[model samples]
Target chain A: MLVAGEHVLFHRARGFGRDTHGASPPTVLRHSLVKRKFFRLKLQRERTFAPVRTLYNLNLRQSGKMSEKIVLYYFDGRGKMESIRWLLAAAGVQFEEVLLTKREQYVKLLNDQALMFEQVPLVEMDGLQLVQSKAIMNYIAEKYKLSGKDLKERAMIDMYTEGLNDLMEMRMILPFKKPDEKQAHIGVIQGKATSRYFPVYEKALNNSQYLVGNQFSRADVHLMEATLMLEELFPTILSTFPNLKAFQGKMRSLPTISKFLQPGSQRKPQPDDVYVKTVMEVLNIQIP
Target chain B: MLVAGEHVLFHRARGFGRDTHGASPPTVLRHSLVKRKFFRLKLQRERTFAPVRTLYNLNLRQSGKMSEKIVLYYFDGRGKMESIRWLLAAAGVQFEEVLLTKREQYVKLLNDQALMFEQVPLVEMDGLQLVQSKAIMNYIAEKYKLSGKDLKERAMIDMYTEGLNDLMEMRMILPFKKPDEKQAHIGVIQGKATSRYFPVYEKALNNSQYLVGNQFSRADVHLMEATLMLEELFPTILSTFPNLKAFQGKMRSLPTISKFLQPGSQRKPQPDDVYVKTVMEVLNIQIP
Candidate 1:
């Protein structure tokens, strides 16, 4: 990839960790800080703002801190954007989020024709504005060589990640469940995790320490992410799944994943009531 | 791709339509039927049945007709597997289905560990047991060249298809909606189809005749399928979206897709009462 008429080097998205691909760290990214009092909408690229939303004037003191890096646009909480954050962190890619705190910010994106489906976690990378979380994850996974190397290996990785996605999606909707129905929904999640989902991952891990291509891939990243997610809901979530526990431990010890696990990293804590309020307020939705 | 120790000559997965790739037919697939008055699942593969259920004795007279090609395992309805069927048909690939009508058939597959995640839509093709509907669709799409040619093009295709899928999934769960809630759900689907989704495709189609890579792709196929689905619910679904209507016309005029649309073909009609009943029984789930 070329930038500024020169071959740009990569440092795993210019992350805090070192690139495992043997690329030195000084090619694709370099930006000087520019501070002004105006609501400048140029996010490493030039764009005119419509002034239709208060978001254009919100405190953007952090923009210069993350200049020229991948820009992720979403709310201030862990909704659909969480998994993309997880995948990028696992790939050792550093990104910054333009958090939407008000409903007008989302509407501004829609009015500018920025979001394809009028929905986000919109990511700007490689000179492209990307939407759809799965597509973004696939792109980052492939770019980082975490996606499989062959067609068959890709098939296995796709299958495992997809199954884990089904499980994660169940919890992803927990905040929307009615208060009366929350318990039963949790029961359903627990039932499906143990009976339907966790067993498959456990069995898949039994044959090899890795999920796809017998090496670390996005599937392993997802498995480790999901186990920790379930553990949040139920502390002993992996009690019956010994292999998954061991797999989670092994995944956490990887260089990239281990760095991500450390404090002061980009990983967000689990969403709380305040986080939920900000998300629902920005998206303008009521709990179902 | 090799099959049976020989370079397999492909005819677009061996269908009624001609292969546009210019490969002569007949080097991989050939099977003679063995007539036995039992539920033998030797669909071009050697596997002994334990005979633990009535599915082992159910009528399977049509298995011989679809031998040596793809074997799709699902119920006789247009559920999640419908898009896979649409993709295969659009690719002009011939496939067979082992329809499940009884709970015991599902139990048998579960006992045999055929389903990786204890779910249906399991497919047998290219000597691999493929699970996860999206994974199966991706595999088939890439094999038949409905997927795009490069990474950027593939990203575009994946993005459009993912958006279309969000719309399609809203209708897919309608079968499980409560009797009294069905009307409201239908209203939601129609509202989202017209307001949220159609405009995106309309604008996308404004730039080119195709959705990705200036060629036919799985995204186009999915948009066509989704528009037809919405039209089934609302006859005037595409009245406001001129570009989408034209795109649909262009897609439907393709030789392979037009053939699949014809009557007396392998295409299943919209699900009626019996189809829903069979699916509910086989899966053993109450309406949520």
Candidate 2:
């Protein structure tokens, strides 16, 4: 049984069945059950009359349970979850993409009492609903052995990936900038940040073929995603750093990675590019 | 020898001596050397004529070199590095605090070539000049065996700590809020976040004495720091959560932690805080 009262309610409400053993639930399940329960209570209290539903139904029919079935929840466009998607592909793991492309669906999920931090790039696996992109990615990375060879390597990967994620967050703010301010902000990024930060990546790549361990790592995946985003905005961005360019090329050519980069699967063009859509839809504001 | 050009310059500039083996420097040493070197180059490039100095001088006189000595560079205030300081205290490790209280000294370190991300809470240990508080904390946690008993425990600790850290980040923005907006923001936090987040902690504490593995952890330390900060601002904040209050009391009762809480070693009041003084002094701006 879970310690939190609301979690107990959530598990019962979600119809979360017994754990894999059917005798004793895992500790993670207790954590998840409580979190979802707590969130559900908050939702019910805040919007008493509104019909709010959990994002995903508790599917207890899978043979392997949480271990076998991986569900990723994110907006329709490939934004924060793209690298995660790439990681799944690279790891050769099959997953269910529960892309909440519609405004209504997003609102519903936002109101869902199960969302920790009330944000996405949430992942459901192994009987737990893990929130926070970094935490989710780390879980996947650890499970798939993509973290690194040793603890030190893992820490290095975490460090590099953290830096890359920070850069991604900076980019996420671009679409929200006013038209007048957008150009100037972009100028600083393209002119100054690209030169300052990219060379750092280029230098890292020069030392090892990959970012962290000379082996493919979550850091490389994160860096590759950043490179794709930046290059999409400014095509000639990577031209100055040959090592990074080559590194980008190498990452893009990975058979698993290449599949995701195909025109059909590639990220949609901006404007409604996830974050912008999130703000516009969430705020009910018309982005000009 | 380190691979990066600037790092080589940095190590030489910092007067870093070769490790005991004297063949190739350790990985952490190389990492520190490169970070310092890279930051130094950036400082030099940006402020060509400015007098840029390193954050801390090379102290290789210690018998064990980097392995033995630990240096934490931050403003005297218990800001981002507070949790780290607590961790070191809890670990009972001796560390040197190079508090950048002087404006010229702080500015010099800020403009130092080795300060990556150009931010503080920089740590020097194990021959690595680690930037980013989170990274440094994780490193220390791992090194000190305070992370968790195993990977699963570590992940759980990470998940809980991540939630706590997110909350901490939210509180960090409180100081900048205008008076008019402050109350509304505090209302949301006290009413919504406290009700939602605190119960989880309460439940966790109810289940076990510690946040993770029923043993002392970095997560508990971080939570303690957050609790202290929150209680400092809103004295009656934890009155509703008896379990958390008890947990805080238990944590405070720890001898090492108690020592840190003692008034003499306590952080001084802000505005004329260390980092602010550094900036005002460095820029020669008159503080009202």
| lDDT by residue (tens digit), candidate 1, B1-288 | 011001111112211110111122111111101111122343233232321222332223223332345777777767768898999999988877777766556655555556776566777776666887888888888888887888778888888888787677667656544465568557656755665578778888887998886899999999999999888888988988999889888887899989988897667677777876776555543232
DockQ of each: 0.16, 0.11
Off by over 4 Å in 1: A1-68, B1-68
Give one clash count per candidate, in the order shown. Answer: 1, 6
Compute the lDDT for candidate 2. 0.56
Q: Looking at model 1 chain A, which ten-residue stretch has the lowest summed lDDT?
A: A1-10
List, residue by residue over A1-288, the lDDT tens digit for candidate 2. Answer: 011111111121111110101112222233334555454554431222112223445334233344446777665555557667777877777677665544444444544544554455567777777765556677788888898887677667766666665556445545544555557546544643353457568878876788877689888888888887888789988878888888888887888788777776534345454555553453233322
Please report, as a residue range, the 10-residue window in candidate 2 chain B with the lowest summed lDDT.
B1-10
Q: Give the TM-scores of the predictions, in the order they appear.
A: 0.77, 0.74
